[model samples]
Target: MKNKEKIGFMCAYTPLALIDAAGYAPYRILPSEACEDRAGHLLHDNLCPNIKKILDRALAGDVPDLAGVVFVNSCDAMRRLADAWQHVRKDDRIIWIDLPSSIDAMAHAYVQGQVEQMGRTLLSWSGSPMDPMAVEKSITSFNRICAHLSELAPAFASGAIPGGYAAMQALYNKASTRDFTTTLEEIEPMPGKTPAPKHDAVPVYLFGNVLPDPKAFDMFESCGAMIADADFCTGSRLFSPVTGGQKDVYSRLTSHLMTKPQCARSFDPALPGEIAKTTLSRARAVNAAGVIGHVIKFCDPYLERLPGIREHFKKNNMPLLILEGDCTLRSMGQQRTRIEAFIEMLM
Candidate 1:
């Protein structure tokens, strides 16, 4: 088996365990500032900037060599991204997974079947057979990675790890390509350095769409605030641990997916207030003084969820700042005044 092959995925819904099981490195296609105008010409300007930046990279052939790319139907924009990729990169093998929007018994079965199918597809792509042991081993490795990240969370929140922005960058970088052990070795604090003394910087929880640039966090910190925690798909959401210890690989994957952080794309009619509750719980966990929601322009799901979020924060007397951007450092820089003002308000 050629272990050098790589498989790319865009959403958190993609099962990294299955990708690893198929003897391919899992690569996350994060947002970048490259080719936004070109992508805007292909995709509508009204689309979310996160999807647009990803398509921009794909169009520019900026991605790493991959055996295939997997796209999950987490939202309409992502589905359209897959469609656009098909037209642009016809030679690349593209797989689309229809993720269930809700969480329930039927939804669980549907997602489990999708994951199993993805595993079969990966095996075919890799010219390998289904290996249950490989799948379980991958699960254990990923869980270890999560455990390592969990250990760093307290240090990160308390300003001991240099800065939260750098920590978040290290996290996304490690998860995208490196294995658990390599990631641990790379991020472990150097010897003989005392933890940075905690400050009275306004503790803030960052929420919303993909913040690809760590500079965004720097901007938050520069404005006299500290990022205590993040509720981003590419950040803390991706590091959620797998539980249940299910023997079946697909069952284990599904169980983990069902309990992970709730994105705007994941809807449960039975729990309308789930996202707000999750956000609140995370904020309170770090004793956050405020919440900042930095979403890309034209992200409908998040825009729709904003009213409820506002109401929740208002009821609790927690300050909430919603800033829309185009998913670039330039755009984020433009919001500095607003962010600084928000932080001043919190202070």
Candidate 2:
């Protein structure tokens, strides 16, 4: 990927396969550091912490040089961030897509259109039209990476391999920033590092907007909580498996984006308790003893629906623990005692 220009993308719904086919490497901008007030002049201080950190990072020159940026209008915070990005980085192409919360046919078609437009822009950037087979090959390579994670999910939760959750988190972080083919090297355990004795840690399912720091997982493990499975921007939902059988590649790819383990932004009004239902399904799949719902501060979509989600979890007899923070390890570390008590009760 040395010859390929890198394009920065934020949301999971962005069509990374298309970016790969366009002869570019996809760079996912994850705000892993503490929120800074430096971006306050660029955007509001009350905005989502993830947004603030991402903008602040760009200003600090901590980000890679990219030919373009992809942003999803999944919520007001994200939309405003895209608008402010122009002020921060004046010379890069910024592509914004309107993500629909509905999962109907109309929504699918709308996503396909957005993806195709994104494809066109990417192809133009490369100065050549991408071959259909290249797109398929790119998707196949991405699915290979996802398959690796699917196999490791059990160890990640069971604590069968000590530090498995941290290892998995590192892989996901690398998968987003580097080439998929290059990421395969670090998938397996290193040659000399031996697996530590497995302990019976309290397995818990974590669902949130973004938990990018591997140290965050380390902190949980220290508190006797093994992240058996999670639904986060930097975790399971990152590179979703794109299902086959659709002749049109865009349709197949867009379907995966729209229907993968979703964030709180999108919903089907006709389906009552959708978020609760999905959360239960995911948590039960891993046989978690309890559920942990972590949301970044000021994230309106998740915050507004949290009350309903909590009530649903309670009704179903699931032990739920809610944590709110600024998307940093410092914030998570402060809640250590609370996390320990919750894990102890489950144990």
Candidate 3:
């Protein structure tokens, strides 16, 4: 244990937990919290909003004790962002891991290789291999966390929990890297805040990248839309359970991440439909009216697949409103009006 140096880690969903397990304080790039506007000037509008926001954060130098930054090529935007990071953080070691976009055995093996490579990079940078015992413990902890989150999502949907309030708490859990057991102990059910069975709002399933502003959520709720479920990598998709109970913790960790629905960069041929089904099922289970998809500008993967997803929803007669923006509150006013109108039509 070499004094537990704090490393600034940024990547798509699955890799965050791994870096944390490797004894680094894994930092997910939350561009909404950034101090400066580096991304607003350089990157074109076609680049992924999340990437742009992250680049802006990097430029602001808000990450004070960052040892290095990790980049996972989970999507094309990330690949280019890694190049940008290389240019900006010339002094920091940039570990770029190529992530596969499927859940098959070959995809698992591909991700496993990436995990092993990340381990070597960590050893070279920190002069330490992730402790085998710690890796195992982390796996168990992550599994528990995933299970608890799964429970939370449904409970939040069923009026057993207040969804907005629970989201606020979960965001804290993610930012602090709290282990599952500790988080569970801290999140006691709100005594009087338990949701009453109310049916005034139209249930909605939301999809897309991390919204930099909380106002986007407020906008949706203002339109009488209750976000019953979501498939965004930063949202519910990021918390799916990692398959555990394996002898090789390293391989299992990679495999678990590769299989989970949380990885947005994954391009499995079946995944788009799988996600559609899952989102629809959850929505139907909760009696949702439609879906409000926030399509981040320049996110090629989500953009490319949007047409097909829209078609699928149409087949099921599930109305979907696709809003394009960079997830900044300032840039999203027009989108808010459109959503408000869409919700009005739904009524």
TM-score per candidate, chains pooled = 0.93, 0.94, 0.84
The number of clashing residue pairs in each candidate reads 0, 1, 3
What lDDT would candidate 2 get against the real structure?
Answer: 0.82
| TM-score of structure candidate 3 | 0.84
Tens-digit lDDT track of model 3 for 1-347? 32455556455444555555666665565665446666656666667777877788778876556666777767777777777877777888777666766668787777788787776677677666657676676666655655666556545544566555235435533644433445545443433344456656777877776663555666677767766776666555656666766678767777766666654456567545565666567668767788887877877767777777788889999988988887676667777778888888777
Clashing pairs in 2: 157-228
In Å, residue 197's CA in model 3 sits off its true spot by 3.8
lDDT of 2 by residue, 1-347 (tens): 55567899888878777888888888988895643458778788888988888988888877788989999888888888888888888998988777887788998899889988888888888897667788899888888777777667656546554566877787788889877667656664433223434668887999989888888888888899878788998777887888868988888988887878788888878986599889988899878899988899999989998998899998898899999988788899898899999999999
Model 1 misplaced stretches (Cα beyond 4 Å):
1-3, 179-181, 188-196
lDDT of 1: 0.79
The per-model lDDT (C-alpha) reads: 0.79, 0.82, 0.66
Q: What is the lDDT of residue 95 in candidate 1?
A: 79
Candidate 2: where are CA atoms >4 Å away? Answer: 34-36, 188-198
What lDDT is obtained when candidate 3 is compared to the true structure?
0.66
**What's every prediction's RMSD, in angstroms?**
2.3, 2.4, 3.6
Best by lDDT: 2
Off by over 4 Å in 3: 1-4, 33-36, 40-45, 123-130, 153-196, 262-264, 270-275
TM-score leaderboard ranking = 2, 1, 3
